[model samples]
Target: MHIFDYSFLDNGLLPAALTNLTANIYALRSASGLRREANPKIFTELEQVARVQSVKSSNAIEGIITSDERIAAIVNQSSAPLNHDEAEIAGYRDALNTIHTNFKDLDFRQADILSLHAQLLAFSGNDDGGKYKQNDNLILEIDSAGKRRIRFRPVPAQETAEAMEQLELAYMEARGNANINQLLLIPCVILDFLCIHPFRDGNGRMSRLLSLLLLYKKGFLAGKYISFEEQINLYQQLYYTALQESSRGWHENTSDYAPFMKNFLSMLYMCYKELDKRFAILHGKKVTKKARIEATLENSLTPLSKRDICAILPDVSPTTVEAVLGAMVKAGKIRRVGQGRATRYIRT
Candidate 1:
């Protein structure tokens, strides 16, 4: 049996770099809390934007996708799923909604985990939704030539139940320990759950869901206003590379958790920074809608789409945003990249 122990987190095992990263994340989290308290209404718009982005990006990560309009409709429950992909997207929306609404009462217990998986596949009507895999599964990678190779072997089916039980217990114990930082313990638990691969499907999505749940429960509420999953989707290569690096030597319990831990922390840090930036653009001394739009594009770490600009400046109408963007492009102050749905603007 593979044993799960997070006692290392209480010790000096984390690298200096990770420690500093966590400190920065903590400071940002605190600042974000203050900002939210100052004006909760401003974040209401951000919450709506993040909800759509979270549903889209989390499902998109597993290759489940639909049109952006359809995704927004599904997430908001204004339309029914028209196909298998849409159905899966709806399931994720339901699961994410449950966490965002009820995370205060949720825990890392096996039953709660099972219930979440059930909600995750509620629309698919799959019998395996709330159950563990009855057979072993492999994490696979496909090469360019279409060759499939086993990336990692998860816990055997017979041992999965016990493994999950132990995982829950380990997380509960670590969470209860004041000596442990919940930030560090979160990634370890997620990595272990992935190694277990409790379900035959939806393992990857569940891990992301659990990531938000745990973070929210521990006062890291940045995911609520900024899509943590979107950040991961944007930097997917780094996300997978971190998971691969940390999942090594797992069966015998010698795997290093730092890679995934750092990745997780970095993602949270980005979410907080993003939340701060969005709020700053709205509340800063820009004084005019056009100036705010320009400031948004100027300070953005990534390119901004028209819709993104509208979200950041909810008071600004889309028509105004479009006109301003066109003017900026014509003036050579900003450059437009991609086309149509992929179009985004960046400062030149």
Candidate 2:
């Protein structure tokens, strides 16, 4: 087997999914134009919201949860951890803050990775933070019956360091070549890292943290305004399925990376799209009764049903809302999604 090789990049072509994803990325990138196009105050507010949601969702995915109010307090540091879960949340907040503040200076090397892990679990009583697995770790899925089955076998503890080195070397070598897209390059490395299961714990959180870092480095600033971790947590099952599918046969270097890549790219696209919608509402845009219905739709990060829009604009008549929605749809400013009562409209 050709371990740690990036022979997959040789084709100089992308698969259909990636090709489509690349096109979407290009369109959104062009739409974004310059960062200055967004209001500074709006961006700052959204960034803070993203931070709180990201830390909360990432921890919640691992079944570590606290009340939304508590999460906010812990994240804002207005309060201390009331329990173990809150303490963990606090640790994540610190690590995420560090990454946000210093990602440009952080290298994607073993030392840095370990350090990030250490910071992630710093408040926890576990002394094993920052250390690689001293024993084999099993990837498992527990059913409702509490039954656990091994999902995949990671690199044994003895080979953990070397495997990590090889994985990073492969990514760095490929990254140096401009022919490969950083978008594709980053996810492949993440898939490999997850499959390797290099750390004893916090692999999932690390993957998400590294995702933010890699995206920022590649100039994908969507995560700064929208919480990608929250998206993944919302679609948690899809995330796990993509990882499981992409990781199959990984040890023999024969795994397909597309599933996870698709999920990653799609989440990124959603983030940007959300950012666009949310941006329209910010920057002191005044709404009138005439534009209230349309503005309400534009203001939401997620698609809104007629009832949803009406609830936000209780003063507006349903007839008026319907008329404006029809005009907007026909004018191509927004389109209908879903069906009937489930129908929602979103800006095109």
Candidate 3:
């Protein structure tokens, strides 16, 4: 389906969920604009932890096995991968690092995506890295008896390049129209990408990498501070179910995007919520009430009304919350998302 098709937006993604996702996406954007940390060390520490978890969780989803300690060591640059699985894990870490360092400058074009895929599978000695599948591949599900059956058939090998080119063009065209929010559009695009299954291997990991890249490009930075892949891994079965549900009739351009979009948005919301709790734990004791409030507002997954703040911080008075929120709004640390009683505060 092309970007102009109504199915992209009207195809069953819940309206309520879309509204909620929009708010969270905006909140994350505001949080990314946070003042240079009062202490950069804490965030750096968390970033490393998040990176390790992301690498571990993403690789683990592919049945790649290694001790947590070893993964941590590999991520920390203290050790080399010991086996084939660990080597693939290391490749993931390297690809992730490239995304982390260059997401700002990267374009989600065919060559860029292929380059990351190559980087993602660098451990493989053959030349499959960064290349489309040269032959048809089946997505299979193995039964309890170890009998594997095809679950889906993707675009034919010869059509992979043309399919991807059209998909990229569709996305670029959609992006030019401001009415289509990229957050919602991204999940749909990922769903189509998975259904296409353009590459020979590593499609799952590549999808997650693309998720982070798109999130960063859209100005939502929660994936960096909290592991998006980890959150998805926590509910891996649901992840597959959602993808399957959304891709049911994808080849015919008659499927629902809601299932996967719901999962995607839920995963994103979890990341922001986790970021809030982590910040409160790491900085609450050291920072003042106002700073804490600032952190809360910035880290919030949704715009929080004054009553919401009071609810979250009962130890602090309503007056204190009000004053802090007011100050934050004035200083551009946060913005009031609505007017009067309906108003809720979010990062600027």
Best by TM-score: 1
Give the TM-score of each candidate. 0.95, 0.83, 0.78
lDDT of 1 by residue, 147-212 (tens): 999999999999999999999999989999999989989999999999899999999999999999
- For each of the candidates, the C-alpha root-mean-square deviation to the true structure, in angstroms, is 1.6, 6.2, 11.5
**Each prediction's Cα lDDT score?**
0.90, 0.81, 0.79
Candidate 3 per-residue lDDT, tens place, 1-348, comes to 323243345344457867777787678556644721554755665677679879988998989968666887888789988888888888899999999999998877999999999998897564788999999988889999999988888888998898899888877877777667778888887887888888888999999999999888987778887789988887889999998888787778778888998889889878877776766645565677776677777766555678656545556789999888888878888877768766878776
Predicted structure 1: lDDT: 0.90
Q: Clashing residue pairs in candidate 2, if any?
A: none
State in Å the error of residue 187, model 1: 0.6
RMSD of 3: 11.5
Candidate 3: the clashing residue pairs are: none
Rank candidates, lDDT, best first: 1, 2, 3
Q: Which of 2 and 3 is the better model by TM-score?
A: 2
Candidate 2 ranges beyond 4 A from true positions? 33-38, 144-146, 288-348
